[model samples]
Target: MTERELIKKAQAGHNSALNQLLLDNYSILKGYLIKLTLQKELAEDLTQETLLKAVTKIQDYEPRGKFSTWLIVIGKNLYFDYLRKNKNLRNYEEYDSVEKNRVGNQEASAEDHVISGLTFEKMRETLGTLSREKRSVFILKHYYGYSYKEIAEIEQCPIGTIRSRLHNSIEDIRRVMEEEGLDGF
Candidate 1:
């Protein structure tokens, strides 16, 4: 069945249709959360929360946008709420131990391995430095390939605000890279 048909069924109290809808978009939603949160376990937690919200609030979903986009909007809001209620404090990351181990030196590696590892870490750090709102705009636009209008709608903000946030976030990342002498500079 088409997505519209599935959505219609889901809205009409077909539990399986709604389950299939959430299952279909689960990976993309989780991946987006991982990229946005920078903390894998937190991403996992938020994914569950997002899914629960989707299940409970399926009736509010409109068909004008992709279901995945709506899921992303919910995920973003939950993350922001978490940050606010927690007073912007994040505890020690259990995922970082794995990340550190992955970046460990390998005897057979060449320049590519070192460059890529450092680049990835630096990029992650730069993004982590952004405010949640700025990071949301950046992730929606660049990471997820969302159009300005779509991001505006998902973020429930003006299109101009979306554009400005994306621009500022990019500028911040660029400045960080330049300061760190990245990109062969």
Candidate 2:
């Protein structure tokens, strides 16, 4: 069935349809959250909360946009709330795990692995320095390939504001990369 059909059934109070809809968008939402929060565990927790919110609010869902986008909007709000609640609780285990996984999957030489690890480290550090809004804009646009207009809608801001945030984020990342001598990346 089409997504619209599933949504209609879900809105009509069919639990199975709702479960199907949520299942379909689960990975997209979780992956987006993981990238946004840079914490796999937190992302998983937020993903569950986001879906729970979606269940309660499914009646209010409009089919004008993708369901994944709506989930992301909800997830983003929750992540912002989390940041407000825990301002100093940064964790790097997620990044470490990501690097380890990459190394495990790659068949490249040790020197290549070292260079890749350094590049990933520098980029992560640069991202860490970005403001939450700027990082969100950057990740949504570049990492998730969301259009500027889509990002504006998800962020609940004017398109111009999204553009400004994205432009500034790129500049911030570029400046950091240059400073770290990883500009080629």
TM-score of each: 0.78, 0.78
> How do the residues 66-101 of candidate 1 rate in per-residue lDDT, one tens digit apiece?
899899989988987898788773432321121111
Q: List the residue pairs that clash in candidate 2.
A: none
The runs of at least 3 residues in candidate 2 whose Cα sits more than 4 Å from the true structure, single-residue gaps closed, are 87-121
* RMSD, every candidate, angstroms: 10.7, 10.2
lDDT of each: 0.74, 0.75
lDDT of 2 by residue, 21-133 (tens): 99999998998887777789999999999999999999999988888899999999898778768774354222112211111223223223323434665756676787777
What lDDT does candidate 1 reach at residue 63? 92
Worst 10 residues of 1 by lDDT: 94-103
- Report the number of the highest-lDDT candidate: 2
Model 1 spans with C-alpha error above 4 angstroms = 89-118
